[model samples]
Target: MKIIDAHHHTWDLSVFPYSWMNNPHPTGDISHLKNNYLIDDLLEDAKNLELIKSVHIQCQGGINSPVEETEWLQSLSDKQGFPHALVVYSDFLREGIEKEIEEHCQFKNTRGMRYLLNYINNDPINCFAPKEALLDTTFKKNYSLLEKYNLSFDMHLWWTQYSYAFDLIKSHPNILNIINHAGTPRKRDEEYLSNWRNGLKTLAQAPNTVIKISGLGMFDQQWTTDSIKPLVLDCIEIFGINRCFFSTNFPVDKKYSSYEKVWNSYFDITKDFSIDEKEKLFFKNAEKYYRI
Candidate 1:
C-alpha cells in the first residue's frame, strides 16, 4: 500500500507571509489552517504507514517574494528528508516571473509552479484571480516558459474554469498539467454537478492533464467515506486509472478528518480495484508525473 501524496502543503506562518491563512474563508471556518504545519506534524497525522513520498504544493507566500517559499521548503527537505519535491508559487501577473522561476529552480527539489486560477461570479471574495486570468497574454507567456525549465503546472481552478484550463493546456502539450482538488468542486447541486461532469470529461480529453482526487473536505466538511466515494470514483472513471491519483491535501483538509482517516477512506472506497489499479492511484502515477 505504498503512497505518494500528489498534492499537499507544509507551511510555517512565522517564517513566511502565508498571507491567505488569515483571510476570511469561503467554506466557513478555516481556523484549523491558520497554524504552522511542519514535517513531523504531517508524518504523525498520516500514521506513517505507507506515505513513502510527498509533493508540497505552494501555500501562498509573500506576494512579492514567492520564491522564498521554495527556498524554505528546500531547506526543510534538506533537514527532514521528505516532501520529495516542491511546487512553489509564481505570480504571472507581476513582472520578473522568469526570475522567480529561475530562483525556484536553483533549489534541488523544485518540480513545478502553482498559480491558482479559481474565480466565480458569485464567490467573488474567494476568487484567487479575476475573470480570464488564465487567458491573459502575460500569464500564458510566463506559463509557457515552464517548458524550458522542464517543470509541470499544478493548476488550481474551479469547475467553471475547466474550459479555460483546457484552452491553456491544449497549447502546452509538452508540460504536464496536474489538476488540483478534483477541479475544485464548490457546489454539489444537480445543476452544478451536471455542468461539473461535462467540464471534467472535456478536460480529460487533454492527455497532458491529470486529476488529483483531493480537497473533498472543502465542500463536504462533514464527509464520510460514503459521501466522497462517488467523487473519487467519478474522477477515476472519467480520467481512467492511469491518469488519476489520490492526495490527502493535509492540514488544510485536516479541517475534515485525521490523515489516518483520510487515507483509510481512500483505501476503503477503492477496495474493489485490482492491485495494479490501486498501486497507480496510490503511488505510481504520482511518482511518474511528479518525477519523485
Candidate 2:
C-alpha cells in the first residue's frame, strides 16, 4: 500500500543540539537515540515497506531555534526524497513566536508546529511543559497565531491533559489539529484505560481534531498485535477512519521493535477493514491533513 507514515523523526546530533533529548524521562529511557538518524537511516529501516511519503515531527530541536531544524530538513529534502512534510517545534508561550513561525514557513514543506505540553507539575521526567501551560492565556494567544501563517497544530500531551486540549481545539476550529502518539496514554490499568478511552472520545468530538495512531510502543514497550488491538480499534471507532491515521514514531519507537514489526502490527490490526479505509488510515488522511 502507498503509505504516508504520518509521524516519525530523524536527527543529526553533530548539527544542532536536540535539547530535550538530553533530559531523561523517568519511565521512558531514550538514551539509545543519541546517535545520528538521517534520511538514509530512515530509508534503510523502512526498506521493506512501500513508504512513499513521511512526516518529520520535531525531534527535540532547540526550543527557540526550531527553524534551524526545518532549514536543515529542507536541505535534505532537496536531495533525499523523504520526510515530505515538516512539523517544526516552537514554544508558543515564548515571546515573538510569530517571527519564528514566519521563518519556519519559509521552507516549502513546513506543514505545522508541535509544542510538547505533556507535563505535570513536580514531574520533570515526563512533563515537557508546565502542567497547566495549555490553559495559559499568553500561550493560547500565541497558539492562535499559527492559523495566521497558514500552519496547522500538532499537539502532544498525556490523557490527563485532554480536557484542556479539547477546550483549546474547540476554541480554534479554523486550524487543523492532530493529536500525537495516540494521546500518549501513559498507563494501561483498567481505570486508566477507561479514562483514556473516554478522553479520546471527548477529544474526537472536536470536528477539527484528528488522532495519529503511533507510539503504542512508547508506553507498552513490548507491544504485540493482540495487546494493541483494542487501543487501535477504539481510536478508529471514535475518530472514524478519516480522522484517524498511522505513524511510525520511528527512531524513538525503534527502541521497542524493528520498522517492519510496527507497521506489520498496524496492518494486522486493520486487516479486516476495507481497502479504502486502510488507505485513508495509512496515507490519504495524512496527505490531506499535512498538505504534503
Highest-scoring model, TM-score: 2
- TM-score per model over all chains: 0.96, 0.97
Flag regions of model 2 displaced more than 4 Å: 62-64
For every candidate, C-alpha RMSD to the true structure in Å = 1.4, 1.3
Per-residue lDDT tens digits for candidate 2, residues 139-174, read 899889988988888888988899999999899999
lDDT by residue (21-85, candidate 1, tens digit) is 66776687788777889998888877757889999998876545877778788888999888999
- Relative to the true structure, candidate 1 reaches a TM of 0.96
Colliding residue pairs in candidate 1: none
Which 10 consecutive residues of model 2 have the lowest summed lDDT? 59-68
Off by over 4 Å in 1: 62-64
lDDT of 1: 0.87
Measured with C-alpha atoms, the lDDT of residue 10 in candidate 2 is: 87
Per-model lDDT = 0.87, 0.88
Error of 1 at 133 (Å): 0.9
